[model samples]
Target: MDSAPARHTGQNGTGPAGGGALAPVHPAAARRSATAIHPPRGPRADQARFALRPRRVHRRGRALPLFTADALAAVVTATTLPAVAPPVLSVAPVLLAALHAQAGLYRPRLAPSALLELPVLAGRSAVLWCSVAAVTAAADPARAMGWSALLTAVCLQVVLACAGRGLVNELQRRAAVRRPASALVVGPGAGASAVAAALHGRPEFGLRPVGLADTAAPAEGAGGALPLLATHEDIRRAVIQNSVGHAVFTRPPEADERTASLVRLFHDHGCRLWLADPAGTAKVTGMRLPHPADQLWGYSVQPLLPRPTRPLERWAKRGIDTVLALIALVAAAPVMGACALAVRVWDGPGVIFRQERVGLYGRPFTLLKFRTLRADAHEAATRWTVAGDRGMSPVGSFLRKSSLDELPQLWNVVRGDMALVGPRPERPFFVAKFSTVHPGYEARHRMPVGITGLAQINGLRGDTSIEDRARFDNHYIDTWSLWQDLWILARTAASFFRFRLGGS
Candidate 1:
C-alpha cells in the first residue's frame, strides 16, 4: 500500500498535533521512482552505485579512537613500571585490547562516558596484570611481579586508562556538538516524539533527529519539528538524501510486523540501529537488555547487531552445491538425454528451451529447461504457464509434472548462478509487478535464486499467494543453514520420485 506525503515541522517545533488521514499514492508511483532514481547508462550510473555501496566505516571507524586510547594506556603502564619487562609491553597492549573488547568496552555508544566504564575497566586491568605476573613467573621466577608491585601496577593501569579514555570521550563530545550524525526516530505516539526531542535537545548524544518513521500509525506532531516518513520509500529517500547514519527505535523492533520489517531496510543501507526504551516497557514486551549502561538521555538503549553473515558456512554451502550439482548431472545424464530426445521429437525441433529469468540481486540469466512448450518470446516472458495447458504437448506436461525438466538447472547451480535452495527466480515482468504489490517481495533478492525452495516444498508452486511465498522465503533466509538446504533437497528428491504433479 502506498503512504501519504511526508509531513514536515516548523523551526519553532510546532507541527501537526494529531494524526492526519493518510493519502494513498498511485500504485505505479514506487516503480516509477525506482526507475528514475537509478541512472540508466553512463559514468553517472557508476558514480551512483559507488555512492550507495554499503559503508563499513559507520561502526568500525567510531570505535578506532577508543581502541587507540586503550592501547596507549597499556603501553604507558608497561614502560612506567620496572615489574613489566620490555617484551611484556607488546603483549600487554594486545591482551588489554582483547579483554576490553570482550567486556563490550569497544562497542559503539550514542552517549559515551569514561566514568561509567570504570568498574569494567578496573576489572579488566586487574586481570591483565595478573596474567602478566603469571607469565613472568613461568619464564623467570626472579623477574615475576611481587604482591606490592602487582597491586601498584593494577591501580596505575586503571588510572591511566581511565584518564586516556576520558580525554577521548571529551574530544568526541566536542566533535559531536560541532557535527552530529543524522538520525530517524522510528515508531509512533508520544514516545517517539519524546525521544526525538531528547536527541534534539541534547547534542552530547551525537544524533540529530532528521525525521520520524511511523509505519504503524501517524506520529503525533510528526515527532516534533521533523518530517513524518510513513512509507518505506519516504524513509529510504530520507536516509539517502540526508545521509542518515543512525535509526533509533522508540520500542523493541519485534513489537509488530510493520516495525520489524524496517530492520532489513535500514541494515541494507548501512545505518546503525538502536532500540531505545523510553517508557520502561521493554521488560513487559519481553525485550532483553544485554547492556544496562548503554543509554540515550536516560532512556535504556542497545545496539541491534545486524544479521550475521556466516561466511564460512556460506562458503561450505557453495562448495556442497558445486559438488552435488556436478554429481547429480552425471548421474541423471541418461534420463536427461531421453527427455531431450522426446522433447525434440514431440515439440518439433527445439529440444532445450532457454528463457531469461531474474536471479540473484535482480540480475537476469537465461534459465535452461527441456522444451516444455513452444511459445514465442513475448508469451514466454509475460505469460504464466501451468500444468494441463492446451498449448503444452503430452511430453512437456509429463516432464514438468515429474520435474525432469528442471535437471538442467543443476548446471545453473554448478555455475554459481543459483543456489540449490533459495527463493525461486521469476521473470523480470513478474518480479517488478509483485514487488510493488506484496510487502517483502523485493527482499527475496537478498539471497541467491534457487531451483527449489521452502515455498516449493510447502506446496506453494504454480498459482499461490505471493505474500505467503515471500514470507516463507524470508523465513528460510533468516534461519538458513547448510543442513536446511540438504534437508530441502532430500525432500525434493523424495517428492520427485513419487511423481507428484505439483508443477508449473
Candidate 2:
C-alpha cells in the first residue's frame, strides 16, 4: 500500500529545478535575513503560511506488506495442521499476528531480510502451534495433535512465512529503487556529507538525499558536494519544495542544542526520523526507540520517536477546552462587558486590541486583548511597553495588574486558535528575537498558545527571565496531562486576586 515517492530527482539534488547545483548561502546571513518574524506578502508567503499546518501521517502504509505476509502465512500453516476444530484453526492467524507484533517482526526496517528474522519467526511459530495442540487436547483428547505433528506444523509455518516475507522484501526493494523517498541528512561537516554520499550511492535503501541540514555553515569548497541547508528556515523550505519524507541524523540529536531543536520541526512535517551512526562515534542518549534497532548499509540505525504525544489525551484536552471556554465566556460576560466599557472610556473607541502573535508550529494568528495602551498598531507590535509607561491610563494599569486584559482570549480558545492551558503566545518580533537568543525558545510553539500556562502560574509572568520561561514551558509540554492542566488552572485562580505588576 506504500505509494512511491511523489517525484524523481536527477543525480544532482534539485528535482524539478533540473540538474544544476545550487549556490550555498552562509548560515549567518541566512539567519540574519530570515523572515521568521515577518513573512513576505505574496503567493509564496501564502504557501509558506499554509505549510506550517501539521501534515498527515504518511508512513503508515509501509508496514502493511509485512502484516499481510504474516497473516497469510499463519492461515496457510493452520490448514495443514491436523485434528484442530474449525474454531480453533480460525484463531491461528489472529494469534500469530499478535505474537509476531510482540516480537517486532512487523516493524519496518531499512534492510529487511527473512534470514535475519528466521529465528524469531521460527520461535513464534512454535509457540502458536503448541498453543493450538494444547487447545485441541483440552477440547477433545482423541483428536489432539501428537508431538511429531506439532513439530512438523511449526517447521511448515516457519518456511511458508519466511518465503512470503522474502518475496515481500524483494518487491519492496524493487519499488524503492524505482521511486526513492526524498531525505535530508542532518549533521555538520564530513559526517553528514559522508552519509548523504552513501545514501546517494545506494539506491536500494529507498532514500534520496536532497540536502545537508545543519545549523553550522559548511566548509569552503564543500557546497558543491551538496546543497547546504544552514538554517531551520532553509531546511523547512527544502522539505516542502522537495516533499521530503525522511530525515537521517548522522549523530544523536541530543549531542547539541542547535541540532536537538530540529526534532519537533521534522515531526510537525510528518517525516520518518532515523538516527544513523555513520562515524560509529555516536552514543545513545536518553531518548529510546519504540521498535527494535535497524541498519542502513553497514552503519547502525534506529528510528527516533519523539516524546509520546498522547493523541487521545490531546483530543480530550481540546474537547475540554471548547466546553470550558464557552462556559467561562458565558459566566464572565458581565465582567468582560464592564472591562470593555472601562477600556472604551479610558482609551476611546477601540475596546478590543488584536495583534498578530506566534502560535503552535510558529503560525501567526490574531490574539485578542482589551486595549491597554493608546499606541499605534506598528508601535504596539514592535515596541516593548513597561508597567509604568506614561502612555498608559489608570484603567490600563489596573487591567494589567489584575490580569483582566486577557479575558478576551477566551474566544480564541473557543475558535480553536488557542487552548485553555499551554505555553503563552508572544509577539512575532519578540519570538524571532528570543528564538535567536535562547537555545530552546523556538520549541515553545509545539503546543497551543494558552492564556494561563505553567510558567505564568509559577511566577514567570511579565519581566521574567526568557530562558527560565522557555525551560518551564517546555517541561510543561513534555509532561503535559489533563490533571496537570487542571492543577495549573487551579493555581492560577487561587492567585488571581493577588496584586502583581506586569502580568502579561
Candidate 3:
C-alpha cells in the first residue's frame, strides 16, 4: 500500500515532461542536504487526546473590512436615498457578505495584494449596488436613484472597500510576521521536515508548523522542531489540538491508498490541503501560487484537492431533502400501509423491517423497509444476499421487485437519516470490509446515504463489483448537485418497477 518510492527521502525528484507526474523522491542518504529528514515515531495514539487550542480570532478579524465596507455603504445608501427602508439597508450587509464570500475575497492569501483583487472587488460592488438600486426602485418609485447616483454608490463602495481591505491585508502581513495560522506538514522524510523548518523559522508566510504526518512512521524518529504524527488518527487529533487551519504536503497526498485516506480525513476536518514544491514545478489547473518564492521562503504550493461540501450547500441539500421527504412521506402513506398489510399477511408479523445500516460518517442507523424475507434481525444484518432464498414467499419477491417494500424508507428520509438520492446505505459489516479493501470506498460516506443511488440506477445491485459500485458512488458524490439529484430521481421514477431487487 506504500506508494511513495523514496520513503523518508528529503529530495522530491522531477517527473517526466508533458505529464504531471512526480518522480519518486530519493532516500535521505542519496541527497546530502542540510535538512536530511527521515520518518519518526511518536507517542502512543491512545494517550494523545490533547485538548483543542482556542481558535484564532484574527482569521475572521482579517476579513472585517468586507463587513465594514458593506455597513458603511448602507449608511451611504440611507443618506443618499432617504426612501430606501431601514430594513433594506440592514439586509444589504448579509447580501454583501454572501457575494464577497462567493467571490473568494474573504479567503486567506499568503501574501495578498489588495490592488491585485481590484477587478473582483469592482465586479462584486457593481452587482451589489445594482441589486440595491433595483430593490430601492421596486420598493418606491419616488426614491428611484438615477444612473449618477448608482455610479457614485459603486465608486464609493469600490474605493472604500479596496482601502479597507488593503489596510486589513497590511495588518495580516504584519501578523504573519508575528503570529500566524497553525499548520500541519504531511508526508515523510527530508522534504517535509525542510518545509516544516522553513515554516517554523519564518512565520511571515502565515504558517506555523505544529506537527508532521509521516505515513512511513520510522522507528527512529526524525529530529526536528516538529514531532512526527504516527497515524491518521494522530493527525486528526493534532489538527484539532493545535487548531490547524492548513495542511502542507511535501508530496502528493494521493500517492498511496493510506495517504489518500489522509486526504479524505483532512477534508473531513476542513483543513486547506496544499502541495509544497520548492522547484516551482507543481502546477495543476485552478490552482493559485499566491506569493513569490522569496515571500514564502522558497516554498511554493498549490491546492492539491477539492474542498468538501461547503456548509451552506450542505444545509441547502438537507433543506431540499426535508421538504421533498415530507411530501413523499405524506403521498406514500397509502402505499406504505398497503405494503405493511401485505408483509403482515405474508410474514405473519413485524410488517416494517428495521435493519442497522451504515450512514453518514460511518454512523449506524435503523433503516426501514417492508419485510421482503422471512428472517430475524440478526440474519437480515449479517446476510449479504436473500433474494433467491428458498424461504422467500411469493409476495416478498413481488414486493421487492416492485420496490414497494422500500416505501417505508420515506420516513427515514423525512427524519433526515437518509437522502432521497445518494450513495445507498449498507450494513456496517460491509462498510468495514470495503473501507479496508477499497481506497475510494469510504469516501462515499461524505454525503448522506440514500434510498436510491447512482450505483442502484446503473444496475450495480447484488453480487456486482464492489469496486465499480464504490467508484460510481464516489463519482456521484464528487459531481453532486441539485440538478443531478433531480435527474436521478427522474431516472429512478422512469424505472420504478423495472428492477427485480437482489444484488444490492
Per-candidate Cα RMSD to the true structure, in Å, reads: 11.2, 11.9, 9.9
**Deviation in angstroms for 121 in model 3?**
2.2
In model 3, state the lDDT of residue 299.
62
TM-score of each: 0.54, 0.57, 0.57
User: lDDT values of the candidates?
Assistant: 0.73, 0.73, 0.65
Stretches off by above 4 angstroms in model 3 are 1-60, 73-94, 108-111, 135-144, 187-202, 214-225, 231-359, 362-418, 425-443, 454-491, 497-504
Ranking by TM-score: 2, 3, 1
Taking the tens digit of each residue's C-alpha lDDT, what string does model 1 give over 305-415?
534357899899889999999999999999999998898888889888888877664667888888888899998888877766788899999987777888899999998
Model 3, span 1-504: residue lDDT tens: 000111111222443211111222222322221222222236643343333322332243456665676567656655665555677667777787888787767655565666887887788878887888888888888888789888887787778777777787777778777768888777766566666667766666788877767756643443334566766656666666666778887654434445656766776666776777644444421133443212345566655554344678778878988898888888878877777787787678878778888777566799988777777667766666445547778878777667777787888988889999898887776666656555456567767889888887777765567667767887887677887787778778777855333222
In candidate 2, which residue ranges exceed 4 Å CA deviation? Answer: 1-62, 65-195, 201-204, 210-316, 347-349, 376-379, 383-393, 480-487, 497-504
| Candidate 2 residue-wise lDDT, 1-504, digit = tens | 000111212121111111212333333222222332234577788876776545643552446788788888877767776686888656888898889888878766787888878888889999999999998899899998988888888998899899999999999888899989889888765556666767887888898888778876743223254566777777876776667889999765644446767888887788988887666532312233433457776677777654445689889999999999999999999999999999888779989989898777667899998877888888887787655568889998888777888899999999999998998887877776666555556667767889888888877766667677777887887678999988878778778866443333
Which scores higher on TM-score, 1 or 3?
Answer: 3
lDDT value, candidate 3, whole model: 0.65
Question: Lowest-lDDT window of 10 residues in candidate 2?
Answer: 11-20
